[model samples]
Target: MAKTLSVAPKQPQSCAALLEKLSSVLPKGHQFGIYHLSTPPTKTDALCHPPPDQRPDRTYCENHFLAVTIKSESKPSSSEPHADWRPVIVLALEIFIFTTAYSSIFFVSKADSTGYLHLLNLPKGTPSPIREVSSAFLAYLIDKRRRKGIQTTVNLFARAQDQYLFPGSIKNGGKHVLDDRGLVKWWCRVLDPLLEEQQQKQGSPWQVVKGYLLIPGLDHYETRAFIPRTATSAANWVLGHPLEKISHYCQEYDWVPPRCLIPKYPDDPKSRYRDELDEEASNKEQNSGAWRSVKTLEQFWEMMSFRQECSSGRMTGFIWVVFDPKDAEVNRGRVGGTPMPNGTPDQAPPGTPSRNRHALSSATPKSSPKKTFGSPSKQADLGRVEQKKKAKDKKKKKKILKGPIIPRQPRIKTRQRNYLVDRPVSSAYYYWPAEGRGQKIVDESDYKRCTELLLRLDFATLDKAAGSTRRWIEEVGMGSQWGLDVQGKMEMPPAAQGSGTAAGVVNNLSGLVRKKPIEGSEGQGQNGAGVNMLGAGLVRKKRKESTDGAEPNTDGSSHPAPSTAEEPKVNMLGAGMVRKKPKLA
Candidate 1:
């Protein structure tokens, strides 16, 4: 029987028993159960009735940190376990958290360490423990958060690398780890099933499981393989990266720099030690370096390029996986918006109508302005009204949007492809600032089509993965414009458009049902990696056939010939051959 998932394992013994089965693949001491690094959230800590100051502590979604270790232990050509089962890691997880009744989760960075985490090779056809542990834990976190009644989109980065636990790629003989491209696909495949969890339910909070990939200097021709990536007329989904915030600040202000060497934040749960360091540095006047001299985001990236971890020839993919809430947009920017410019004139705000041109055109002309000295309240109210009008005018002027010179689109002669020329960068083996500028605003239908295609893709092999991408573009791109003006009053996502939403994973004793495949996706029941959309963990991999000119079995796998072995007393059965190692020799 397939074991069901539990978001929060209530019985420690049962959880321990289950984990013990996976002990060989789990990191040492972490094999038993999850270790929480954060305090539980409380109800009183969420957004106040009327939204209060935008601070992390009182945010609607509370951020939390989680860490886990896993690795695939494949055998080498020489009939031994693949070397490099353990290599020094630099965490690719995704970051950049939460507490209120609703907790937002992100993997916290494990500070400054470089080393290998040993791997124990499991029986052949076993999936990589690394992907398993990571996926399972992430699913657990999502589910736990869902149970808390916190419905918000979850955002995190997924940069693929050999390992993510350590800072630098240590020189290890292990070459079994997936490369950057494979890592991204592998992550996608790993997380793809999560979508099934939401599609299974009518009111499932986890609505989408979309991915946004930004590899610098990649052109449309190259990037077309990964859905529509750059910004177009429709919706610019390629929101800027988090690191660029530092740069934005520098550009806006003559910002005195902090320790820019590491991308640690003061409120980061794991990196609270940064606060102590800041205090000490201030007391001793010891904070000084090129870090202090930095001014712009470009300089930040330039410096980041030199870091031991990033300098490696391996390109780090800037990826975003957003588990969006259909009704709950977690971003504080749009929440509790200011009542939309105070509605129409009839149901106008409960104040003196403004003397602005728009209001004056409709307002009944007052016979004479009754500005008596006795009525200070009216005068004061009028003065306040004038200030608000002035501020509104300034705001409008500041954001004066120039309408398109050619209002309606010119009639298509043959058919125009998307305008794919986003600002390209000069790739110089470094992470440039604004790494995620290639934006695209896919329509809802296109977005759904692309995500479905991506899920159907078989990333089992390079050839399959390539073929899948070709199929994806051919099918999803047919009659689909990458740029289309959003016409409806749709609940569209902001700048980060390419993502699918999956707010929480199935954490408890229930399996998610995969949604009925849409029309064309029915035949696309392809599989990648050893994954079940239900995320029950430890699924068996379908081993490949040998390339040595042997015919594969009817099952698409080649069975190894059994070796003959002698029984000490009783004779062993026919075909069950297992011989004493080279008896004559």
Candidate 2:
């Protein structure tokens, strides 16, 4: 007969053994919780059961719960051989749960009527995944707590709730929701203090704070709390350049706030957002009042934070020199060798001597005739030699007097074209006097120094200096036309008209005829008065008669005219007929 093997029923696995198995398989940095189902399926004793309504109701229990929360650990238990296997099973389950959670967060097959949550597939390279996960976990925790009607508050949960909700709504917590501004504010509340602490510890401001603040969602809070107090400090944080360099550049270029020499962060998204914000603010101001009318710290921050578009294909921090029309005219004057109005012939600039002086010096002096008893041939030779010498001297004098023909400096043809090869001289080369007559000359070395300094300045430095300059302009009452007009109220005589011109003559004659009655001729007949009409015709007649040698009556036939000293000076339509020099005494 075949030997029969009897098998005993298999025993249920112990919880410790299961836990050990889970611990072994789980990946590092992962935690898993295990719970037993409180409601196990039950079999009914149908034979003894009465009718359905009279039978004990077994429809459903009001509450189903999990028992014993257990977490998987990375370390294996030494007491059991299968300890390492437990965490692996737990890790697999955890992966499934994590994937499910992420999928639900991103892509939902159906919409929920609750309206508290939304599902959106985030763009490929967003930084919101971690935050989203945290939010979802918080939501789950809040729901669990509410279901239990628990009144206890977890500080971490409270903080997360505040970060996820609108300001002042955290205490009246409901569901966890993401509020961008609130999140940014929360970040500032945490990071700003940390930045300050780091600054204190390092004995200098932290540059990383600027980078953190400029991250897309966080930059909105720049003016709200995190920006450095001073422009120089902000520059140092935003741009890795010295404040002095920026200030010097601004001073050189005369660039005020919102008109920096260099464009900053033109391609950065944060910068772009800041620019949008600035543009919005600018538009609002324009609509509500004057554009950029109010100079506040808020405005300053907006201006500094804005990024300019470089359609010119220039690099960030590139220096652009602008030549005003007046500057170009002045430069042209210098290149053309024009003499200074105040300077005399003796004081003419070198290489540009006075033309009159040159003419006088170049004239040939007359030579006395030579008295010599010489042969005819010798005389002829001597004469020829003298003529040749004279001609040579004349040519040399012409060359000397005319000097070198220095060509005019070439002008930049168009404003749009950049002069990469021929950059403009720096402001230091031209001294701007407080009196504002015009720029004066300076040494070449100073110009070079200023140019190099300006070129070295980065965007942030220039931006900071611009803001400071604007503030200074405002403080000195030069920001608006009204303030400038008030400062420019000094009286000045009306500009003189061109008296020699026909139009000017007519104007002057009309004024004289209207205002002044001709002396001793008031009662003259209309015919005689018609000839005496104050105009170019009468003036021309008087001039022609004077030039043709007509003499003024000194025989007292004409009425005694006013003395030259007493006669009022008048234009007389370009004719100077002031009572012909009164015979002395």
Candidate 3:
């Protein structure tokens, strides 16, 4: 008979122990347990009603025990075997969720309903297309600046909004929800040049009109939308450098006269303390010599670089300069040469080996010292630094001689293409001093014709805001004959052809014209019969000439020439006679 074995059941661990044990055994892929809880089947009940053998796991409870089961990966498999890349699937899902959330934040924060409408109107799944279009637009702006030898920063979103919105709306606007902080800052960079141009035009004898920086955007409360920069920074950005770095560059370079001269040795040992003397001497030398006179901006840069190089002791001649091994490899197996760093120059830097200087010449200046393991490398470094300094100075001087490498002003590229709206063009026409002449009104007929032509012209452009000139012409009431006729109302002829509004306008114009000689006194003549006839004729002639294009020569033979001694002084009482007695009278 087989030895009797006790069938005692294994003891259950405490809930805490069981939980810890379960957590450890469960693979990350299998962390999820059963989907829901249900009443457990008792051991006796299982005997009466057999349990379903298809359950994945035979879970145990106080009343029952169950067996573990394996799951099939797929419903249909060719070989009845499938690979479950659970880890990969789980990782991918996590990444998808994270990416979606991140992208949503950028779009959802401040987007206007109109913006969404616009997005919807776009061909479905158009973000990719829009991005392409935007990229192209940005590239065009960049290329435009480049072609003009300028650098600028542009924000496509802001430009797009500007194209759609009216200037007054933008100016007196509330906050926009979709203003991206980065994009706004970028816009400021682009607009730097325009602000600079404004500053230059209206010389800041007092305060300058800083710039039109939008104060409210999505984060208006956090950061101001627009800010002005020094003219230098503006110019730099227009030329394509980052605005933040522009100021740092300006501070580094001090302006003065230029001369490439050897450093002078002091006359005494105490020369170290003679900075004041050196400054005075330097100034005096610079002031006296034509060589030192720096006329252009480039020369100022050269002078500054020269000063720095000299003071830094990097101006010593020919020392072998080794860059990293990678640079050496790039230079075609050469280990050392001068590193000629300079301001923007199209040519290859000086001290570069392509110009044919021996690599051995990169050795440092000879100084007597003990032959030690560490010394040569240290000497080599010193040599390289000295070489770098001289090379830098040479490059700087070359840049200076090139003359005003940076343009004096920057240009602001217009926003994206748009059609102008709402605005109309108008003008105030009257005679004033001509180009060093007496005065003449512009051709009223021609002006009227231009106004009419403008009013009827079509302005369906890709850039609506950009087509503002069209709007300006329209809003200002500058158009064809009709527009001019309306303006003519301000000074209607004594006889108006039409009645009602047009006639009223013509009457108004007549009134304005009749208001008279302003503060100036009228012409006078003798009181005799001859003077009366002459004065009446003159008055009538002037009135007729005002409307008709009857400009007369100043030296017309109608008036008598002045006698040299008496100089034909006007009679004060007659000259003081005013025209068009005031209505108040």
Top candidate by TM-score: 1
Model 2 off-target regions past 4 Å? 1-177, 199-253, 257-585
Report the C-alpha lDDT of model 1 over 70-108, residue by residue, as the tens digit: 333333542334454321121223222333323243433
| TM-score of model 3 vs. true structure | 0.17
Estimate, for each residue in 1-585, the C-alpha lDDT of model 3 and write its tens digit: 111233222322112322232233222222211100011111111101011111111111110000011121332432223644110000000000000100100000111111111211222222222222222222222222121111122211232232121222233222233233444454455335433443465432212212223221113233332333453643332221122221111112221111211111212111221232235455444333213244323333334324422233321110000011112222221112222233223332232112111321333112211121121123445676899999999887754355557757877878832111111111111111111110111232433353344334322321222133335334433342111100001222334323323324334465457544323235443342333335632352221122346554465457543243242245333443656666873
lDDT of candidate 2 over 1-585, digit per residue (tens): 111323222332123433343333322233434322111112222111111112221211111111111122223433444554221110000000001100000101110011111112222233332232223232222222121110111111001122211122223232244443354343333223323433455432112322123321124344335433543334223322222122212222211222121222212322353445446565434332222432322343344323342222221121111111212222221211223233343442222222242433333212211212121123334666899999999887754446688889998767542122122211211111121110111133332342233223221222222332234223322243211100111122234222223353334465456556578777778667535457553553221123346675556465544343233345354444434667887
What is candidate 3's local distance difference test score? 0.24
TM-score of each: 0.33, 0.16, 0.17
Whole-model lDDT, candidate 2?
A: 0.26
TM-score of 2: 0.16
Q: What is the C-alpha RMSD of each candidate to the true structure, in Å?
A: 31.5, 49.8, 38.3
Report lDDT (CA) for all predictions.
0.35, 0.26, 0.24
Which scores greater on lDDT, model 1 or model 2? Answer: 1
TM-score of 1: 0.33
Instruction: Give the 10-residue window scoring lowest on summed lDDT in candidate 2.
Output: 93-102
